[model samples]
Target: MDWDKLRIFHAVADAGSLTHAGESLHLSQSAVSRQIRALEESLNTTLFRRHARGLILTEQGELLFEATRTMTKRLDATAARIRDSEDEVFGELRVTTTLGFGTLWLLPRLPRLFALYPNLKIDLMLEEKLLDLPMREADVAIRMKEPSQAELIRRRLMDVRICFYANADYVARNGMPETAEALADHRLITQSPSSPQVRAGLEFSQPFVAAANHSAMTVNTYFGILQGVIHGIGIGSLPDYVTADFPDLVRVLPDVQSATIPVYLAYVEELRHSKRVCAFRDFVLEEIQSFRRRALPEAPETGHAMTP
Candidate 1:
């Protein structure tokens, strides 16, 4: 198999035109056509069907194209890794985490990370679905629960629990509920049980849903619930980590909380020595430490303890 011919075929198939592929590869259209013809002869199969509009891949071409596409992505990733210096942490780092943590916690702290590594490129993927780290779906992940995926290096970052919270203004207007039974009088805001969330969060929120006699609002993401609480909507079930970022939110029902869920940071074992991955891991650990320190005490006026 000729690597050059395969490369040319991939480009032409991708572009669906001889001229376009030639322009991309800096070759004459005739030269590209010749290479494609040679590749077809070598494979003893028709690779493409030429139409008036452009070229379409034959079944064989489609199969070859799929292999080439995967090869190209892997090669690109390898090239990026090779380009990274041993000491300098600068490259595209894809980080995936739940939408709530990404928006409420990690997003706020990214400016500091960027300030330190000005050349670093961060591709933040915020979703509840776990990306396949070993398959390179994402470079790193911070998951609410310990990642069960194989062929990965995992580190427990911290533990978080869900608790009830409401804006100070909302509390002032409606008064705070000191007991679970008293929650019946106030509106409840929470993540829907059907939504993708940690079991601990769902468990904490279920009691509130059952107890609320007034109107209730159910959002799919914690970000939405946080926003509702910020605007004085009602008491919401939120992770304790959010207290550090939102000092004005008053913790209600201090004794009621969810069992702590372990938060884990994980990446493929192959990336253990990668400079970008190491830098990100260290930065996250340091930031979490700082967050923990800040969350030790409540803001002077909020009159409620921050989540631990």
Candidate 2:
């Protein structure tokens, strides 16, 4: 019931030590202990179990801690939104995207963004799992497919195609496959079909995996597959975007390509006017335009859109 007690409890639960929590809160250890004891008495439950190591949360404490954690996240979100009202594009912007795209494409281009907004703090969360933007899991997302979340402001970014490529040395040794059927002769490297990936990419590799009698080296992330290909492990099914940076990768079966996977940038409707979000959106748009010009000269320009 007491806000201050809840705050102290959250800190103690987080740090798992009275002294540590006290140091962070700028309180004496005895004061923190007294508050914890009083809060436990108020709640009529044992919140923590003290031992020689540190404090361990009781079942009740775990439940209370979860509530306090949510409260903290909401508070942080509010503070971030309040900070966004200022005339500067500064503060933390949590960005989430697939590991492949984040590392291969976005990470490489981040220096330009940092150059423009030195005060900007970016927390890039790279994974295949889609985070809930509306729930404040992340501030923004760049997904291979359009996000299905409601109340999101989505903008179509670009299309990616899964195509076969191999290192120049590997191609020189194994020779390029002229047809889909010819791929049986060479080792294949790719993301596992069961891994979380764009449908188009998985579908593209299916036939090759079957042709190789499931002998392909499958990895969970595109970066792993890229490394395998780079080391001459095998011809890899990779997104076409890699060609811009990895020129040494020779395209195999040039006529064979996966259906285009649409990439989309999305954020909660609430963040539509956030300066940090605007700066990031604009930076990505500019970089996408530049990328098209350099890497995909023939790809038509697709302007940004505000779709549900």
Using all chains and alpha carbons, the TM-scores for the candidates as numbered come to 0.82, 0.92
lDDT of 1 by residue, 1-308 (tens): 88899899999999999999999999999999999999999999999999999999999999999888777767766876786645787889999999999999999999999998998999999999998876677899999877787677888777788989999999999998878899988999999989999988888788779877899999999999999999999999899999898898899998888997878888887677788888898899888778877884442222121211
Runs off by more than 4 Å, candidate 2: 51-53, 213-215
Q: What is candidate 2's CA lDDT for residue 140?
A: 93
For each candidate in the order shown, give its overall lDDT on alpha carbons: 0.87, 0.90
Candidate that scores best on TM-score: 2
Candidate 1 versus the native: TM-score? 0.82
Residue 189 shift from truth in candidate 2, angstroms: 0.7
Error of model 1, residue 171, in angstroms? 0.6
Model 1 segments beyond 4 Å from truth?
1-66, 297-308
